[model samples]
Target: MTKVQTAKDVIEQTKFFHRKLADFYDNLSDNVEKERVKILLEYMSRHHENLAAILDDYESEISERVLDTWFMFVNKKCDLSPFFSASINPDMTAQQVIEIAVDFDQCLLDTYEGILQNEISDEVRDVFRGLLEMEKNEKIKLAKNALKIDSM
Candidate 1:
């Protein structure tokens, strides 16, 4: 039998995803040869960490009724390997790192959009909508920062 997931469960899973991305970037930063790439990787690492923390705060502030709402459509196991397995190398330029970072954010944005498309309750929809909006804003911020890094 498939296991049902609550909104809280989804939020927790997303938090874990961000943490894993942060670790990936952190590890890459240590191995990268280019100083600029290293700096961008470190920044990406912190960005993911901050996103996870924001999720924690979001989860805490949400009503239990919304948190406990079951997502019957979200039972499939979340596979994050695609994000980790992207063609990233220590020799990648700052622009390359930024591209990867933006791609990762886009993947996350797609996930939220996918979830929001399901026929969930309004409260649950609202919760995901909020997350989706946050991700969109962060992606723009990351792109702007990438431009700044490129100019350096």
Candidate 2:
């Protein structure tokens, strides 16, 4: 790896915070109905896996700070949207679940891109950016299905 300067310190700290951010979403996998959020949650887990890898390479302080700040950041920023709540109700259509999943995936992708910009390593950033692109493609693929179901 190229010699990272002060940027390494900040990148490591950001990775730490993001790891917990990734972890919180990991926890959400168990929170809802089957076929509702499971696939989206799985996609989220991939990003968290990346974050965890970064964490493993970082020093103690950055890791610790990320663990500490994750909770508050999630509480304030995460959104369920009208799309997601519909998935939980029995009367709602299957298309709603697709919509929710697409949005959920998009949110995860957005965060990945944000983190990529702050990353010190091009290797790390490329991994995250690739994942973000994957998320977007998945979201698009799911969107057509969602609209198809709505028409039924």
Candidate 3:
């Protein structure tokens, strides 16, 4: 991946990644046979869509002043290429699907955490913090929902 430079660049990259995630979930929903699992995947897909939109709004609201400020890119393995290549078979259990989703969330959270470790302007830090919080909340929600689905 190309080296990220500014706060806006990071946000733009994240937004692109998130849109890809939304697409992944949508594809999973399409491939899954179980109605409940399908619904869950669709909900997650929508959640990712909302996340991308949120970042887009942030990018817009963050003035060029902060957006253009240089921020060091922390080299971390944040690629979702493995997920993109994953085969979503209809026979997979809801638990298995949830496991994959949770892993993906964790990977995202880790990436944001890595970003936080880097030197950045206060404005950029705040943006990253908000993104981190959102990821955390999403992970918790995913766990809870996964539990409900597992019990079904």
Q: Give one digit per residue, the lDDT tens place, for model 3 in 38-107.
A: 8778877887899899888878888898888876656567555558677678876777777777767777
Ten-residue region with minimum lDDT total, candidate 1:
73-82
Give me the overall lDDT of model 2. 0.49
TM-scores of all candidate predictions against the true structure = 0.87, 0.44, 0.86
Residue 117's lDDT in candidate 3: 88
Instruction: Give the candidates in order of TM-score, highest first.
Output: 1, 3, 2
The TM-score measured for candidate 1 stands at 0.87
lDDT of 3 at 135: 80
Clashes of 1: 0
lDDT of each: 0.82, 0.49, 0.78
Q: Which clashing pairs does model 3 show?
A: none
* Model 3 regions lying over 4 Å from their true place: 79-81
Pick by lDDT: 1 or 3, better one:
1
Q: Output the better candidate (1/3) by TM-score.
A: 1
Ranking by lDDT: 1, 3, 2
Every model: Cα RMSD to truth: 2.7, 9.7, 2.1
Off by over 4 Å in 2: 1-76, 80-87
